[model samples]
Target: MPRLPPAPSKHPSVLGVDIGGTGMKGGIVRLGHGPKSGTLRGDRFRLDTPQPALPATMARTLAQIVSELDHREKAPDADSRVGVCFPSIVQRGVCRSANNIDPSWIGVSLQDTFEDALQRPVTVVNDADAAGLAEARYGAGAGVPGLVMVITLGTGIGGAMINDGVLVPNFEVGSLELDGVMAESRASAKAREREGLDWPEYALRLQRFFSHLERIFSPDLFIVGGGISKRPHDYLPLLQLETPIVPAMLQNNAGIVGAALAAHADPADGLLR
Candidate 1:
């Protein structure tokens, strides 16, 4: 393979976009050298995810987001490079599976599509993996040693596994089977809403899920993310397990900041390899 470019320094700003089932959000991120280093330069810009969400349509929308966010006045040092996190299983820039996205996304090259649309250098990663990286380096999991698993309990369960600070990309723990069904089907935030579950009832599902994970990897820490993470006290205390679990500090912004980190850092620099 050809050599990759050297990682950018901590001072420059990079554009980060997070594509999800409901919305696409973007912002310019300024990176620093310590924990919670990624900060948005301006208000986050959001657009509804288009119906059908086809590659061509979404690419156009993505380009629009890039155009709106990559302004010289707001981010003078920002270059024509972008990092994107998508709701899919991305490996080496290719999307292997679609999550809450059109089935046409499977087998597509996420990096190339965005790069072609925006005419910029792009880094693409799985949304959950991006969140996990952010949490591991700059959020709740920061300074923690050994294995850390970041789990986002959103519309679906998304997982990322980090050892020390290096990411073991595409961990996909959400797919694990529990009670004869995919774990997310019963344990995810969407499932809670769909089933009209109270906080304690939801905790029961989460307890089962976490217990299952404990029996397997036995991670050093578990960082819970997603919209639900903002209200962690409601359900987190009810789960009984040997492992320590905490809410993600970055919460909804983790993917955006993590995408920026991926864009500015080289894959070999304690990121994905």
Candidate 2:
């Protein structure tokens, strides 16, 4: 891997916004030493996602959140870029789906919307992809060699593929069919909750899903994320596979931290500093 450029010495900070179905949260991520070495400068602020959540309204809300967080910083860093984690498939700077938020997000240029709203350079990425980036850089997959896959088991399974520290964005492995059913339909966190399956049963479902993935990608490491990561021992111990699987470290903060990381790191460069 090539040596990464050092972070800005004078004012190394960026705003990270996580847009979800229910609420939007943002904070200033202080780049301590490198892109992965980021921490919230202040408390993160959140606002309920607007009703209808139209593109225009959401942009205004994001602007407000940026303003709120920017003011909290000791000194306004003009070079601070903005990164947003949107709960949709972002392709070529455009959002391709609107599963949780308003359907208007489809075909919207989210990167442009956020840039126009904040009057600054912006990087927009999928929420799950952002979370996976965080994990690969600073969480479970950190320093791990070979292919690493971050699988978020929430309402749906969201996957992110990373080789070393480089991200392979938008790898939706969850949509794959297993036993004639979408993998997520049977193994997602929502499926466990809806079915009232105990940890052992849920682990079995995860084992099946992981086994399917192992057959294809043969990833070296698997980092399981999402809200369920809090209770890793409950389910992780039950799984038995050749590939090592572990829970995410940053947990809920991964998306925000990774957004900030992505904002600072150039996309042309595969690895984050």
Top-scoring candidate (TM-score): 1
lDDT (Cα atoms) of all candidates against the true structure: 0.84, 0.80
- Any runs in candidate 2 off by more than 4 Å, and if so which? 1-11, 32-36, 75-79, 267-273
lDDT, candidate 1, equals 0.84
| Residue-pair clashes, model 1 | 0
Pairs of residues clashing in candidate 2: none
Worst 10 residues of 1 by lDDT: 1-10
Model 1: per-residue lDDT, tens digit, 1-273? Answer: 212133344557788899999899988877766432567787888999999999999999998888888664666343467889999888788989876889998999888898889887889878998898777767888778888999999888999888866677888887999899999899999999999999999999999999999899999999999999999999998999999999999888899988887887765554543
- Candidate 2, residues 128-165, lDDT tens digits: the string is 88898777666787778889899988878888888766
TM-score of each: 0.93, 0.88
TM-score of 1: 0.93
Which stretches of candidate 1 lie above 4 Å from their native place? 1-9, 34-36, 76-79, 267-270
